[model samples]
Target: MLPSPFAFERPSTIAGAVRAVGKSGDGMFYSGGTELLLALKLRVIHTDRLIDIKGINGLDRIALNDANDIELGARCTHNKIANDPVIRAHVPALSSLCANVANIRIRSVGTIGGNLCFGEPHADPLTMLAALDARLVLIGPSGTRVVHADDFIRSELETVREPDELLTVIAFSRPTGPVTYRRFKHGERPSVNVAMAWSLGPSGRTIRSARVRVGALGSRPQPLKAIEDVLQGISVAEVRPAIEAVLPTALGELEVNEDRHGGAEYKRHLAGVLLLRNADEAIAAAGSA
Candidate 1:
């Protein structure tokens, strides 16, 4: 099916783009339109107007800020991110994830902003971003507001973004230790994915803190608080045994859903499996560093 008739407007400025969308009342800001255009064609989403922000300057930049946080412009495509020197140096795991997202065609054209805005639970970026404690910057008529990645997605296919707000940047502090991600998939999207970020002690062998997020098993990626708690203050050599001890209880805490991916129990099991795999990689990274 074709998309419903809609007006199109291209704005060269962020303010102008926001105004155009707010004025239309049902207008959506268009960047790489990979998912948006598909949703439109399938009639899964409707908009009276598409406010194109592609002409806006600086929305596709990737840079390290004065505070040492890495900022990714909302319009940056997966292909660019995967190949960016800054991304590869600061967060190679994320660079690898971007390089492997969907296919070459989608990576070339799908904007990170659109992926988060679409809020598909079966997707990738959000899970890793949440684990990295990334913040999303949104600009609207009222001004700019920064939201934690974990809080950005409100539900499956839903986010906290206001219709008139434009997602401008994704920022995160440089990782102090290893960051790892793993996913299990049988189709276009992940059935289960896990992202884990660690903060090691000065010795670089002790885990001072850990953040674990499991995705594609619930409405949104959720923290495995139980696992995180167990890993804290433990040495890399003890991670496997420690995780194994608490694995069952931690897996039980997840709120998984039975869908085409698998049964709820099966997904919960996958989450545990991926977390351990991520833990192993993180241990190796920490050891080598």
Candidate 2:
């Protein structure tokens, strides 16, 4: 595949990279080029210049802060996140998600920031991060801003980031309860995926709070607010039916698109199925904890 000739810049520092972009609206930041190169090859996106941010220092670091929040560098590859000891211990569900992203090659080269910035509907991390209540760190020419993961992606193939903005890190407080995720995939990317996070009460036997996010059937991940409301304050014993009872209505309200992934109805059905499966795993893990 041939991509249109474009000027490329590799800056050694974040500031240099930001300045290199200048005011040209046609230039785009590049990191790990998995999605960018594909889009370029397809000619779905056209840009006169490519600013490579991967050359910037410390962009691939993943560490835990004193507050126990996980700070994941945006340039961190899926392989790095998947294999990092801190990530595996603090957020194993996320590690599992990263481990299973695409095939080996893509995971090796795909940066989490680039993945989120690309805003592919069927991708995995956004849904899990939304449920995890992760905060995205974005840097632009002016300064840096933090945004909740839920507010980052506005729709399919779209995000709240301006062209001049580069996502730098993804941060989230460690989960107090077991987190679980499940996806229904007929191909490489998920057709429909579900992520559930729970906050166990002091007893560890009761659910204090929960989050349910359904993805891949629509432009972006959507929270099943009603289902979450139903699960709160319930005992572990009731986790299944409580979620299932309200799930039908919750899934109905989510915006499902009839895309190549599947028909609207089929995707909706898969959403329910994957959610139920994830619920089972989460409940079991909580019990063991």
Candidate 3:
């Protein structure tokens, strides 16, 4: 089905885009048009005005900040993030996740901001950003503000962003050690994916710090903080059971449903397996480095 009739506006400047959104109560910003267009066609989203930001200059570049953090432009595509040298070096887990998003065609046009903003529960980046403690930069008439990625999502498909605010960039401190990620998909499409990042600190032969993010298992990517807390000073081999033990409680409050992908029990089970495997892989990678 085709999208409902809507007025379109291409804003060449950030100010122009902000103004356009402010003018209409139900306006939606257009980036890669991958998810937004599909939502519109399905009548899931209705907007009188579509503000296109793709033509705006300088919003498509990817740069690493002085702090060694990545500053990903809101318009940066999945393909760009997946292949960017800076991203690969600083956050290899993120790069790996981006590379696995959908397929080549979708990644070519899907923007990072779009992916996060769409607020899909199963999307990979949300989990990665949360685990990395990434910050989102927003620009609006009231000026710019930085928000923690974990705090940005208020609920499913909801965020703190105001109507006039444009998500400009995402920034996060780079990981200090080798990182690895693993995801379990059913027949090529990812049913559940887990990402683990590891770094070594002053303590020798121990996990200095770790971040675990579980996707496709909750409304938002649920961080395995309980497991992380358990692993902080313990040997990597000793933490696997703790990781497994926390799953029932970690996901106790969440509502896991049976979808075309799998049953509730299956998702719950996969979440545990993926977490164990990812944590193990990340720990091995950190030790090897």
Candidate 4:
């Protein structure tokens, strides 16, 4: 299936892209055109215009600023992030996730902002961003406003971006402690990916902070905050029970429809298994560091 007829514009400036999208009201931004093109071909979305931002300068660069944060342009591709030295050194968790976001082909063309903005439940960026407490910079007619990763995605394919706003930059603080990230994938479908990141305190025995993000199990990425709360200040030996205690509660809220993979029960079980395995790996990584 081909996409519905749509007008295309290559906006040279951020303001221009914002104006175009604002005017069409039904326009979608295109970067790399990997996912959007596929969605369009499948008729998953209907739009009157395509505001291509590839022509816009400066949105494709990756930089680590004076604030010691990794700042990425909206158009930065997965491959760029995965291989960037700054990103690798500062936020290896994000780099690890990016490295695993499909094969090299998809990563070569998939934009960081495009992936996050699409809000796919199983996308790696959401989970990694949640762990890093990333911030999104949105530019609109009214100027720029920043939003945290946690508040950006309201639901599956739903975001808080205004019609006139374009996501320009994604920024996150550098990780101060040793970080470990792990994920489970169901074959190569790029769905039902579950990931968790863990960081230990100075004492090296207590869990200072942690993040648990489950994708492909629900309409939106689910963070296991209850489990995170339980892990805080606990010794590594006690983390397993904390993870187990919240597994059922976390899986209960997901909408795991039967797919080629398996049934809801199977997905729920996978989520628990992923939580345990990743949690252990993360703890181990921190302990060794």
What is the number of residue pairs that collide in model 1? 0
Top TM-score model = 1
Instruction: Rank all candidate structures by their lDDT, best first, as comma-separated numbers.
Output: 1, 2, 3, 4
Query: Residue 255 in candidate 3 has what lDDT?
Result: 59
Would you list the clashing residue pairs of candidate 2? none
TM-scores, all candidates, are 0.98, 0.97, 0.90, 0.87
User: Pairing residues by index, what is the TM-score of model 4?
Assistant: 0.87
lDDT of 4 by residue, 141-170 (tens): 889999998788888788898766899999
| Residue 258 C-alpha lDDT in model 2 | 87
- Model 4 stretches astray by more than 4 angstroms: 245-258
**Relative to the unseen true structure, what is the Cα RMSD of model 1?**
1.0
User: Model 3: per-residue lDDT, tens digit, 1-289?
Assistant: 9989999999899999999986446788998888889999999988988999998998888887787887888899988998999888778777877888888878999999998888877677877787777899999888999999878877778888877789998887777654556677765446777766666666546778777777766566767777677777777666667677776776554457578778888887787777777777765775666
lDDT of each model, Cα atoms only?
Answer: 0.93, 0.90, 0.78, 0.78
Q: State the local distance difference test value for candidate 2.
A: 0.90
Kindly report which residue pairs in candidate 1 clash with one another.
none
Q: What is the lDDT of residue 267 in candidate 3?
A: 85
In TM-score terms, candidate 1 sits at: 0.98
Off by over 4 Å in 3: 186-189, 241-255
Candidate 3's C-alpha lDDT? 0.78
